[model samples]
Target: MGGEAVQTDITTEHIERLITAAGSHGVTGAIKELGVARTGSIVIDELVFRCEPPRNRHAVPVRIDLVHGTEKAVHVLRLADGEPVTSSEEAPEDACVRLEFDLAELVTLVYGVPRERSAGVHRSELLLAAWPRLTAAYGISDHELMGSVQRAVDSVLGGLSHRRPSLNELAVRYGSDKWSVIHWFTPHYDRHLRDLRNEPVRVLEIGIGGYAEADSGGESLQMWKRYFPRGLVLGVDIVEKHGLDAARLRTVRGDQSDRAFLASIAEQHGPFDVIIDDGSHVNEHVLATFDALFPHLRSGGFYVVEDLWTAYCPGFGGDDENLDNPGTSLGLLKGIIDRIHHEERDGADPDHVARNTVGLHVYHNIAFIQKGVNAEGRIPAWIPRSSDEINPR
Candidate 1:
């Protein structure tokens, strides 16, 4: 099945073009025609695609069919006047078309990443280009056809400009297109991760979901797994998650905020190349995990903490308006900033954190701590000699 191809009337490229130009319905219809359904609704609007032989074409009744999970299903019902039947059943005498699809293909149809500048082509232009074939398939008077297709195109494009490239195009492709899920952080992530896409690295993510349920978490882990192909993905949560472990993926249940438990994790499964804390966003918990895990990160590795806005909330640690509370994660990170320049100020012996932290990047509600010893030693203390003074000497 890996190298096998599935047959369809439209080329996959054309289907993709339809999807990018026409919208979700284009994807649903194209994928359905390819037998690629899995849990979603397929809407057939008769008025839009009028059938031939005027008797069968009077504002065809709109039908909305629900497709369940992946199973090579196709309903070969007459688009004119027949009910859907299973793949095993013999199609009725007047069956017009067969439609079906599976989960994986549906995901691809909805979330497929296109090449640069490929998705912004004008929908009207696409419709205009395909007009002759579409008109032959659906009997519509040429005089009235443009208006009908223009309305349909407008419905599909959703007011999104499709004529130019956008800065957030990659984010649109990979992050928000698949589900209702929204992770606004993907664009920022793309900046740092573009080069590491093919590397075989270990990524440690803390906080698996499914609150109070043993096997509920791992969505982020799943995303990471797909994004990193060859990389190993490990997840840790406070609850026991079963049935999620598989090749290149491992899960452990432990309190990431606990120093000893965090240390044990490092010894057992870490010294990680990248560590992400999406765990308990409680200020103390964040500080605790960072303190315990930052030292264990491999040199030149990255340590990231998300959801720092919780540090300003009462339940997590500080007063809503306070940004300087020493007890909050943000406050603790401010302390780390001071540590970065400890050599120039009169202070207690520079903390190991100050010595090893080579870069501290603070962004809105997130922080990235890069670990490495500063190989570029301090600039030689400046002392300029005046020419006259040197000559007199």
Candidate 2:
């Protein structure tokens, strides 16, 4: 199938099943079901990984193919100084080194857990023959050609390994502001989400970052993709993010404050395991999004709110003087605390947030609200309601 055809047929469920098959059936069996075309589309076309810079200053075009029986899907990638500048199905006319693998082996390398070491890389014999021709035709020295090949091999191996960088490391690598001086949110995320690393969970983050620039943001989205190896991560932005979609990462354009829009996105893509509000940070916008999206969060999932400092900033619809202002995000959180203990108070009537929320963890400028059944029965009415009655004062 052509790349377009593969793209049209492939869905999130298709990719998730491919990952599951790789884990359960092993390479040989998975190849029988996955086929070469769909595997190539996922690895080369969808998860277009950024490679480490080549040791040499020259650019290299490496062709990768997924082979299943006699059928193969070929993709040529041009890498310059570590960045993947171009990718196409058309093979280059000029001689170049080629990397080939069984279709299922490629799938295992991309989706298997770190402990899985069954996937093997196979280098084509033509690589040896191409070196001499490359030296003569391109005027590249034998040493330079070898360096380029080594770099290409290293880059491919790095991506294929299931072992991933930590959230902080990925944050720096992807240029996200999450771990920087302004906000140290990665460590907290790691603490909360480390257990869910291998599960096929859906994650939604409200903000897409780079305000208006179409191509500038999505650093955190990349970090989440790496952090949750089996996750399907979605980012919602007010502006269109033209080139940010990837194998498991998707971007949707919408306003966070619009309850209907939030509900629609959640309905379409969610029952999410995690929902993070790193959006506009305007207190009202944050509050509105929480109310609209929290119900869509799956039971035992986490709903996170970042930039709580905005709750005190007047410019962002916050009131510093009245910290208890019910209009702000912090105020809403304070109210939830009461809801958590709603059973303790006489004549207390719990609302939706109170009925569903089981745990509330608040840090300096962020909070993680755990969703679950909050229905521990209230104190028995037979118990004395007043301290005076109990003490007999």
Candidate 3:
């Protein structure tokens, strides 16, 4: 269903101009990339980007679709250097695994990785740009990790987790312990999440930074403001991420872990549809947030906490509740699994305060989540009626 194309002269200026034209609607278009090094042309509609092509030869036109998004998929099309090649044995269409990148400026954006500078353009982009040239541009066929992504599915309900950021990225970010931030991949991320589900959805992103306060109106909130147009959003951070699309968003300031804060949230946005814990990857903070707010989640709603791996390493451990070793969450989730699968045997008791909701899965990826509900699509267990309810497993 997805294919590539060949165009000429795709430049930054051209992209900028087109995006400007997009205004409120945002840019929606596609590009055809090609070449093997200083070879073919990079065309984005009428505009063309001048860049090197691939090395192995052949001028085959690779037709790829920016299917998730036509206008905002500029970042995904970054790999498509425009040069219409007829045929080539190596980079063939049948090749299921492919990694693409812009080769020339690998160092600064990567090695000697620049510390985050809020003053400049969106920091994430600067870093990704320095990545090694030409890496996997689409579909990852990792047999083992598929289940991991599946776990993520049960945790979030709608979001799809792809094996993004290639091997070189792994080596670099994890290798140097470098903080690999992301630049705005606009259309790609938006398009992807949008295409993920047809149902209308809203999300609550918590834990923004101090710099992103209201006085200055931070960029993070602004980014989400535009990204999710149809869906509603509620953001909570220690410091506000300003410029939120107030028309469709609610920005609040409170402790991400405080019960009072959580209650206020429930009162204000009580029962969010999707909650993302992108802030304060701390254990106590995570546990506290989940404990109080999860009950308020809509049935079949999504509750997510990013950076779950922190529960393992001792250095990153925050509070004892986080239970760093096997992850407090893992222990909790495992018990839930036991409760759900082996009910009645070992405290399989199903009497929960928030009864009726189903306990689905456990995972230790970048984030952890609880992603489902009962047949009624409403949280089944408001009150823990079973013995397991008295003592959280």
Candidate 4:
């Protein structure tokens, strides 16, 4: 599994292969592919995993190394008693415990569907000889040190579980507005997205909140990352949001209304499994973005539009008086209904939107458009076109 150079950019395809190998080929096969620099790079990124809080007050440092061939990336997690776990890429001089894992195994543990776990799969080393040095350096008793170590191990191991929190819980934890804040959209999202939870999906969300603030938004992106363990979550905002980029999460600065920019991103990062329009709630922006990105959505994937209440707000180019105005978001959806049934009508050529939209689920202020082949041949063209023709005979 060793390689000559380190892989810098880990693509969605690489992750998919690693997941497939982990499930079908077992540890040896998965590890062999993971040994490549690119795969190893993703496994080593500290941001790819999340650690739980420690129970004790003693600061216990633990080291985890994802090893592939001759290459190894060292990661250290510091669990301070009663504090959140902190991670770093630097290897510690001496840690209370050091865990060594095959690069592929670690990836499987963190991102594999249902998460891979078995008895005696990876290696764990307890640095017993360093205990005295650590105790002396931190001025703690053996009892405290042991307690801290237990808590540290528990915290780290807890994070590697395949079980995920509910979408509402994640939304609240990640500070996303999709929940109780203004909209009760998480439940709807969970219903539509539960099937894709374990998939190695590419999710693109337009409108990274916290306008213009580099580090402010991306709560939903983080939520998506946690919910879809193997997913690559990406966000787009009009402002520069490079601050939010991390392992499996990327941010691009571009206007959602700009078709060219949307097309460019879709070309580079698409055939996306899920594309959400949470950006500017303007009716025009929503319609334009849908036009630009819908084609890039993979078949059977979902395209979500949030905050449809904007369709009635005059400030956002909506007409409360005339809801059927085709320019509004709701108006667009109304038209899609016809497009989806174009085959049933005379002289109706199924356009791109109609041909690809197999299902549409509209909720309170959100809608989920399901992409699939809409060619369920209309009534075999021989079924009675009118009740009068059949009854007259």
lDDT of 3 at 104: 16
Q: Which segments of model 1 are wrong by more than 4 Å?
A: 1-183, 383-393
Q: Which ranges in model 3 have alpha carbons more than 4 Å from their true place?
A: 1-200, 210-227, 242-245, 315-327, 342-346, 351-364, 367-393
Model 4 alpha-carbon miss at residue 53, Å: 4.3
Which digits, one per residue and each the tens of the lDDT, describe model 3 over residues 145-200? 23322332222111111212232332232221112343223232333344422233
Worst 10 residues of 3 by lDDT: 104-113
Every model's TM-score: 0.53, 0.86, 0.42, 0.86
Instruction: Give residue 382's lDDT in candidate 1 (0 to 100).
Output: 62
Q: For residues 33-118, what per-residue lDDT tens digits would candidate 2 score against the true structure? A: 66666667766653345344334356666777778778888877665564444567775544367878776666766676546455
Q: Give the higher-lDDT candidate: 2 or 3.
A: 2
The alpha-carbon deviation from the true structure for residue 27 of candidate 2, after best TM-score superposition, in angstroms, is 8.1
Q: Evaluated with lDDT, which candidate comes out highest? A: 4
**Which should have the higher TM-score, number 1 or number 3?**
1
Each prediction's number of clashing residue pairs = 9, 0, 75, 2
Worst 10 residues of 2 by lDDT: 1-10
Q: Sort by lDDT, best first: what order?
A: 4, 2, 1, 3
| CA lDDT for candidate 3 | 0.40
Provide the overall lDDT of each model, using Cα atoms, as 2-decimal numbers.
0.53, 0.77, 0.40, 0.79
